[model samples]
Every structure is written in structure tokens, then in C-alpha cells.
Target chain A: MTLTPKGEARREALLDAVLRVLERDGASGVTHRSVAAEAGVPVASATYYFATLDDLFVSALRRATQQQVALFADLGEHDLRGFAEVMHDWAFTHRGAAIAQYELMFLAMRRDALRADAEAWYGALEHAIDPERLHPVRTRVTAHAIDGLLLRMLWLGEPSTVGEIEAAVREITSAISA
Target chain B: MTLTPKGEARREALLDAVLRVLERDGASGVTHRSVAAEAGVPVASATYYFATLDDLFVSALRRATQQQVALFADLGEHDLRGFAEVMHDWAFTHRGAAIAQYELMFLAMRRDALRADAEAWYGALEHAIDPERLHPVRTRVTAHAIDGLLLRMLWLGEPSTVGEIEAAVREITSAISA
Candidate 1:
């Protein structure tokens, strides 16, 4: 059923709550009650909006991925240094969201329904890198390399300096160019 | 306290059980009771072996990282292609352990005590890649890139082909050599 504007806003709020919970407590902390508590809504509201806990997670994941894709879509406008700075800031400042994204990725490994979203997220990264500048395989490889670096930074709880990230971006770009 | 031979064996068994539970269930599934059950030991045994759940997780993560470092330390013996093949196979066959490692990494992000282990894990990887051949920064960058690539493969639940991994490894090696 189509939600009224108010209902739509509430739904969005609930989804945001799911992400907050995921980031704060990881996947296991995300239950119907926990999400509802995080959202400041009644537990019934979560069940009403998303029939299953999986549905809530999937919906939140889709929204988060879309926002990220949109953010990356604009990266081409920035030079390598500028792009690296943006990435460095984005990851460190948005640590919670970044960690939550990885949590969803692990969840995708076990749940078939979440696989497409994960692929699309990676596809967005590949596209943002502007694969046209490189060989097809190199483009894919570069994207994966960047992915791994960000993940490592997150996992280690160590944010790379802008200079370090710039050097990495330049290295990958140069490799693809070569 | 130094343990007798049997006590050491029991401790090892408990740690293995932690990994098993971590692999089968995500980090959240790991609890005192669950680990004890996995070890086929009494609940008291788990509590006796590790004073707290956090202690158990920390000990298990250390063991896992050491084992990984040992595995990577031998990579020099293999040619690039051989190394790539092994990586491809490892990611696919040990998918559970791979994911569990990532899960632990996220846990490390939250828990202060676990951060050093995570840092050392990356340090071992950087050492394995051998920075002497590359500029110190380049070596660090290269290590992070490979990490990103491996993590992407695991996150997407798509095993890279041997050719794909080999190409990526060669590119990184060549870039460092240059």
C-alpha cells in the first residue's frame, strides 16, 4: 500500500534506526524490538512496516547502499588528491555507517536475497572509479583493491591520512594506466 | 599460570571451539555456553579456562592472526601464479573462517583490547609482502590494496579465478618493483 507522506517519513526513520543499531551493536543486536527502540517507535510499527526482520535489514541496506552510490557517483569531478581526501574524511567521520555497511556485507554472504544489493554496491564503486580509463580486468582489480584498503582501515580502526590515501589512489590509477 | 600438558591441550581445545562457533555463527553467536558446547566440555570448563567472554575472544583472535601470518610467511616459496591459486582456493574453501576473521575485525573496532591484535595482523601482512623491495609507503599501500581485494572477494561471496588473482598480484608486485 502507498504510504502517505507522514507514513513514508516514519518508514525512513525506522530504516535509519536499523542502520544505527547495526552500527552500534552489530548484526546480532538488530532485532525487531531493538530496532523499534532505536527508532523511538512501538515494536508493532517495525513489524507492520517490515513483516520479517530480514525485510527490515534488506530495506535498510538498500537505502544505505543507494546513498553511498550517489556519493561516489560524484567522485569523478574531483582530482585524485581531492578524491582521496574526501574518502579519508568520509570513512573516518562516518565510521558507524561504514562499519554497518561491512556488517551487511557479511550478512549478505549467508542470505541469498541480499546478494544483489552487495553486487550493486561493488558495481557502483567500479563505475565511480571510471573503468573506461583502464582495461576491463584492471578496472575490476583496482576497484577490489580500493575496497580492500578501506575495509582494512575500518577493521584496524586506523584512519589513513589524506596523503597516504592519495598515494594509494595514484598508485592504483597509475597501475591501470600502465 | 603455566598449565600442565593436559591443561594446555584443553586450552587449545577451547580456542578451537571459539573459532568453530565464530565460523558457524557470527561474532554475536559466541557466548560462554556456546563455546563450551562446541568444545564438548562442561560450562565450568569454559569459565575456568577464560575468566570472561572478552578474554576468550581476544585469545582466539590472537591465535587466528598468528596462524594467518604463518600461512602468509610461506608465500615467498611460491611463484606469483602459485600464490594466487592458493589465495583463490583459500578464500573459497575457508569461506567461513574468512568471514569469521572479518567479524572479529569489526569486533576489534569496538573493543579497545582487540585493536593491537588487529594492528599486528596488518603488520604481519605488510612484512609478508616484504617492504625492502618497495618504498616503505608503497609497501604499506600495496599490502592494503591486496587486503581490499581479498576482502571484496569474500564480501561478494565470489571466489576470484586463479587468473584474476594472479594478475592482481603481478600488478602490485610490478608496481612495487618499479
Candidate 2:
């Protein structure tokens, strides 16, 4: 549904609040009441924006994924350091959001509706790596490796520093290029 | 805890039931009573085996990981086809348990207790790739890519067939070797 500018801002606030509630209490704790309370808005406001708990949860996930896609798209084509910093920020600095994003994929496995959102993440990574789409096969294979690296960073918390992450990125690109 | 052979079998059954519940109902659906009912065991048996929901959940995760590690270890070093088949089965045929394994990583992000279980998955992959522990950095970089590929399979359902998965595995290995 179309929303006014003020209405849009309120919707975004509610979405952001969903992530906070997810981070703080896990998925089970989320409800219209909890999200409204988290957003400091009326319960009616949350219910008006999100008809159900799944709507609230799914919208927040979409927002997180979109933010990540934007981050990847904004990177310079050959900016290993910039990529590393973004990776660090996503995995460590803004960790809850990253987890929420991955949680979307897990949910997508069950809900066919979210499959496109899940694929969008991989598409963003592939575009960031090869903007011209020069070599589809090579780019995809490389994207898979990088995807695995991101999961590693999130799960194991290794390549903990930006410097280390940069080094890992270098290894991936150089290995693929060679 | 030590168990008689029959007792051990019952405990394993309950753990398996947890995955079924998680697969069917998501994490929120899990409770000692639910798992016990799933296992067709008395509620007291589940409580006796696992004192709390967290205990039941974590132990099921640990069991799933152990099974996966054993699968990896059993493959012949050069058995790429076997690896592909195993991966396909894990990601598709036995999809729920695979999701449960990944869910463990999500939980690991918050609970320190599950970090080792999460790390153990990566370690298993690394060991499968480089059994002699040669080429530490190369093996790890390769592992990251392969890990990403597995996640892709789960989320996007790509490499949907064993042949495609085998081809993807070949691409990863040959690219790294080149």
C-alpha cells in the first residue's frame, strides 16, 4: 500500500524496531505489541503497519538484506580494503542485523515467498564482484567462496579484524583470478 | 552420562525427534513435552534425558554435527562424486537435519557454549579437504568457498542435482588448484 512520507518514516521505524526485538529476544518474542513497545509507538500503529507477526518479521529481514545489498553495490570495483571494512562492519559492528539477514534465508527455506529475497543477496554479491557480468560461471563460483567466507566470519568470528578480513578477501580474489 | 545399550538407543531416538520437531514446528515449537511426544516416549523420559529445553536443543545440534563430521570423514580423499552425493543428501534428502545444523550456528552467535560445535563444522570441512593438513591457507580459503556453496545449496536450492553439485565441487577445486 502507498504510504505518505510521515507514514513511511513510521513504517521504517517499526521495521527497525522488529530487528531490535529479534536481536534482544529472538524470533519468539516478537509480536505487534512487543514491536510497538520497542518502537515506542502505539500498538495500533504497529498493527496498522504490519497485519501479523510474520509481516513484521519478514519486513525487517527484507530491510536488512536491502541495506546489505546497497553496501555491496556501493563498493568500488577493486576495493579489497573497502570490501573488508564492509564485511567487518556487517559481521561484527552491525552483527545483529547480519544475523537477522541470515535468519531470512533459513526462513526462506520453508517459505517459497522469500526465495527471491534470499537470491537477491547472492545477486548483490555477484554484481559487486563482477559488475559487467563478464564471466558468469567464474563469477558465480567465486561468489560461492565469498559467501562461505561471510558465513565463516559470522559463525566463527575469525578474520576478526579488518586487516585480517582484507587479507582473506585478497586470497579469494587472487586465487580466483589466477 | 553413561547409559545401557537400550537406554542409549532411547536417548538417540529422542534427539532425532528434536530435529523432526524443529523441522516441522520451528525452534519455538520445541518443548520437553513436545519432543517426548514426538519420540513416543513418556514425558518423564525426555526430562530425565534432558533437564531443560536448551539442553535438549543443544544436544540435538551436537548429535547432528557429529553425524555430519562422520560422513565427511568416511569419504575417500579423492571421492568428489561421493562428496557431491553426501552434500546433496545433507542439503536436500535429509534437509531438516541440515537446517538444524545451520540453526546451531545461528544460536552459536549468542551462546558461547555452541561456538565449538559451530567451529567443529568448519574443522570437519577443512579436514575433508586437506586430510594431511597440507597447504593450510589454501585449504582454508577453499573451505570458505565450499562452505558458501553449501549455504547456497540450502538457501537457493541450486546445483539441484548431484551432477550439478559435482560440477560445482570440481570448479571450486580446480580453480583453487590452478
Candidate 3:
């Protein structure tokens, strides 16, 4: 569907609002009313953007994927050195994204459309990481390893010491060491 | 609640049913009525066995914990080595369970009581793998890394190869080997 510039901007705002809703309140927060409220538009405007719940879900998921990809993209054209700092940021802020993503994952398991969105998200993630420089074997190994670490920290949120943080950095560096 | 042998056996059957429900239908499947249907018992039997939803959640989680522990108990109690085969089993047969556990983790995020239950589950997991072996730096690092690997595999399904699997196994073995 073609959109006027204003409509495009509003759509971006709506997608951002949906991400915030999903990030904050999770799956329960994604109703049409809530999206309208979050995006500063009337409830009717939500329909203008997303024709159905499936459309809304797919749009929100696309926004989440783009946001996550930008997160890694912001790390710039650097080597895998960017991983540790990104993880540290996740330990601080993007914490809830892990849960939202996990829940989406289970949802994806049973739904082919959602699974396609998820796979697209993962593909974007894989692309942003630039896996060629590191050994493909080690790159994939450490990729899952780092993903797991981020997930566990998000789940438990155990208090971390300076030393513990440094050690986690060292361990990741060593695992996929260039 | 006190129980005759028949009642005790029925309760045991009910808990087994809760686990089966979780494995099949995930967290939403644990309601008193749904679980009763799965167990082939009267709905009243659920209220008889589990007084409250919280009690039911804890019992179901604890039962999951026990089965997992018992499954590993046969590994003869080493560090990372003991879990290798079990991890492989999960990497295959119970991929769905792994996905569900991660989804259950998201559900826990919304509830403090359930989060506490999650902490308890992690406590059992941590107990199985000796912290001392992870050394001063690697303790939490190792835990998080393993978690990331498992979830990534569950998400990707069969995309990973034996070489990549061995790379993960090698990293864990090397960590505790330290």
C-alpha cells in the first residue's frame, strides 16, 4: 500500500509505540486500544495502519527486528569486539526485550507467519554481526553462546561485580578469538 | 493435605499430567480444569490436589525440576562433562520443552511469585554445576553462555551441525576444565 509522507511518519510512530508497548507490558499490552493510546492517535487510527491483529503482530515484530538490527548496526563496521559492550547495554536496558523475544519465539513455533517474521529477524541479526572474519564454526558457536548469556542475565538479573563483568568479557573474547 | 494410597497415586498422576500439559501446551495449559482433563480425573480433583494457582505453579515447576534433575542424576555427578549427553538429548527430543521453558521464563517476568519460582529452578541448575570449578571469573559467565547456546539451538532447530555442536561442547568443557 502506498502511503503519503505524513502517513509514513505516523506509521513509524505507531510502530515505535507498539515496540514500547511490547517492551513494557509485553504481549498483553498490544491491543488496538493500547496501540492507539501509545501512538497518540485515536483507536480508529490503529485500523488505518493495521487491518487486523495479524497485521499488527507482523508490524510490531518487524519494528522489533529493525530496532534490534539497528542496535548491532550502531556498533558500526567493527569486528566482533562490539559484542561485549552491546551485551553490557542489554544487561542494563534492553533487558525486557529478551522476554518479549522469547515469548514471541514460542508463539512462532506454532505459527508459520510469525516464524517467518522471526526467521527474518534472525537473518537481520546474522547479517549485522558480519560473521566472515571470524571462523564460521567459532562465529556460530560464540554467537549462540553470547545469545544464551544475554538471555540468562535478562532472566535472573543477578547483581554483577566489576570483576564478574570483566571476566564475562574475557570469556567471550576468548571463545571466538580472532 | 493428607491422602490414602489411592489418593496419593492420583495426585502423582495429576502432577505428571501437569508436566505433560506443560510439555505439550505450555504455561496456559496448567489451569485446574485443563490439567484435570489431561490427567483423566474429575475437575474437583485439581482443587483437591492444588489449593491455589500459585501452589499449582510451584508444584508443576518443582516436578519439572525433579524430572530434569533425575534425568541428569544418572550422569554420575561430574562438572560439565556429566551434562553433555543430557544436553544433547534436549538439543534433540525435547527441543519443544526447551522452547517452552524459555516461554515460561517470560511468564515469570510478569509475576514476582513466579519469578521466585524461576530463581529456585535456576538454583537447582546452579547446584548441579559446581561454582568452584568455574573459577573466580568464569562462574556466572559459564552459566550465561550455556543458556544462550541452548536457546539459540532451540530457535534454529536443525540448522546447526555436529561440528558446531562440538564447538559448543568444547567451549563448555574448556571453561569448567579451567
Candidate 4:
């Protein structure tokens, strides 16, 4: 996937703006025109960057999932304190995308055009945890728990504060630590 | 609310079809025509019975909410047996309604007209938990967890089994058991 420098820069800016639109108004607020306005570019730029709504959505979801996977990967060896804080802070760092991602998931599940996207998104999620050698059952439940916590927190749009993050993580760890 | 026999019967039939449509098609599939068709009534009857689209959505949501509340209420006194069963038995039941409920929730959050509807739903959920008397700090977290668990298990679709439910409840009980 090679592109001109200008094209690469434009694509990055467009992706960032899509994230912004997703943040402020959720998935409903995102559109070709809106993303263009958000990126300070012509509407055609979005079409140039991505072929269809599904293309854009799937790419964005992949990017978000990669970020999430990287975030988890970098946290060495689960000290509880460090890992928990980061996990707790996630709802704060990317609240809009979290909400939009979940909303898109609903679309994926309900419509034929998007089920593959949803499946791929979930596959990325399970892959992020790497099921090898873990208690398959407990690991599956734990992943669901983690996914549920993030999505639910997004659904609630709970404002994050330092105190709130600490408290939330502590409560979460309390359940999962066993 | 008292009504003529025809009105009462129509209302009950409408609500039943509402749940059916929601379970089969997620939030987007709901429409007066669909409900009327599903219930074997004419679309004109739906229009006559429901003054507006918003009214219909609210009524359907209310019925769905009430049904869920009743289900939980029947569990009585916070014992986790049936809750566990529902969470675990996703294979047989399919998590259609769970996913549909979340979709409707997202839809409500996206628009002002619906947000009010959504808030009432959340308020009922809050009341359902009875966040008084034991561990106030943990109550909200517990509520969020429960919300997350339901959606997550729904997304997981079927791999989550009855034993998983039993184990999860045991874990939860251990954490919160004073």
C-alpha cells in the first residue's frame, strides 16, 4: 500500500477527523460531508481515501483495535496497579470512539453488509488476548468481562476523573483478581 | 389503565409483536407496518393505535423494559440462579433481544427525542438495582458491570454457558458478600 506523501498525509488527517466526528456525535454524526468538514478538506477527499462507508468503518475499527491491542501489549506482566489504571483510563482516553465503535457493532450484527466487519472486529479482540495456554473458558469469560466493562462504560458515558478511574479499576480488579 | 376489550387486546398483541420484531431484526427493523404484519393486524390499525413514531417506539421499549424488569423481579431478592441461567443459556435462546436492546439504547442516545426515552430506561435500571444499604461506592460499579456482562454475553452469543453463569455469580458473590 504505497501512496504519495500528500496522499498519506491527507489520509491520516481524514482518519483523525473521522475519530473526532465519532467522538462528538457518535457514528450517526459521521458522513462523507461531515468528515470532510471535520478534516478541513473537500468532501471528495473522503471518497478518495476510502471507497465506501463500510471501507471507512472497517478501517477505523481496525485502527482502534490495533491501538487497544498495543496498549494492552505494552503493559508488562500485569502488576494489577499499572494494568488496572491503564484499563480504567481507556474509557477516558477514547470515549467517543468507544461509543461509536459499539454503535457500529450494533449495525454490524443487525445487517448483512456489516457482519463480516463485526466478526473481524471481534476476531481482533480475541486475538489481542492470545488464547494459547490460558484457561480457555476463564479467558473467554475474562475477555467478555473486559470488553463488557469498556463498552458499558462507553454506553454510560461516565465522566472520568482521577479518583473515578482508580475506584473503577479497583472495583474491577476486585472481581477479576480471583 | 382501563380500555375497551378491543383496545386492550390490540395493545397486548402489539407489545408481543414488538418484542418479536425486536428480537428478530434488532432496532432498525421495527416499524408500524412490520409490527402490524407480525401481529396479523392491518398497518392502519397500528397508525390508529399509535399517534406517532416516537410514541410507538416508546411504547415498545416500555413493554420490553417491563418484561425484562418482570423477569428480573421474578428472580426476587438478588439470588443469582435465573440470572445465571439467562446469561449462560445464550445458545438456545440466542442473544437477539439483548443485542436489540443495546441497539435501541444507542439509537436513543444519538437523538434528543430519544435520549429522554433512554434516560427513563436507565432510571428504571438504576431502581432495579436498589443501590442502597450496602457499599454505596461499589453500587454504581456493580450496576455498570451487570450492564456490561449482559451485553458482552450477548455479543459472545453462545460460548458462554450455564456453568459460566454459575461461576460468575459465585465470583460476584464472593466479591460483594459482606
Expressed as tens digits, the lDDT of each residue in A34-87 for candidate 2 is 989999999999999998777886788788788878999999987788989999
Candidate 2 deviant stretches above 4 angstroms: A1-6, B1-9
For residues B40-108, what per-residue lDDT tens digits would candidate 2 score against the true structure? 999999999898877887898888888888999898897899999999998999887788667656765
Question: Highest DockQ: which candidate?
Answer: 2
Cα deviation of A31, candidate 1, in Å: 2.4
lDDT of 3 by residue, A29-128 (tens): 6888898899999998988888776577677676676666677766665344465566666665666675665565665665655656656655555555
Q: What's the true lDDT of residue A139 in model 2?
A: 87
Candidate 4 lDDT, A72-161, residue by residue in tens: 666544444565566556665755566666776666654455445545545554444443525454444445545655654555555356
Worst 10 residues of 4 chain A by lDDT: A133-142
Best by TM-score: 2
Candidate 3 clashing pairs? A148-B148
The candidate, 1 or 4, that scores higher on lDDT is 1
Off by over 4 Å in 4: A1-21, A24-56, A71-94, A110-160, A174-178, B1-18, B31-56, B76-81, B89-92, B110-147, B175-178
State each model's CA lDDT, in order: 0.77, 0.85, 0.65, 0.63
lDDT for predicted candidate 4 compared with the true structure: 0.63
Q: Candidate 1 — which residues are off by over 4 angstroms?
A: A1-6, A131-134, A157-159, A175-178, B131-134, B171-178
Candidate order by TM-score, highest to lowest?
A: 2, 1, 3, 4
Backbone clash total, candidate 2: 2
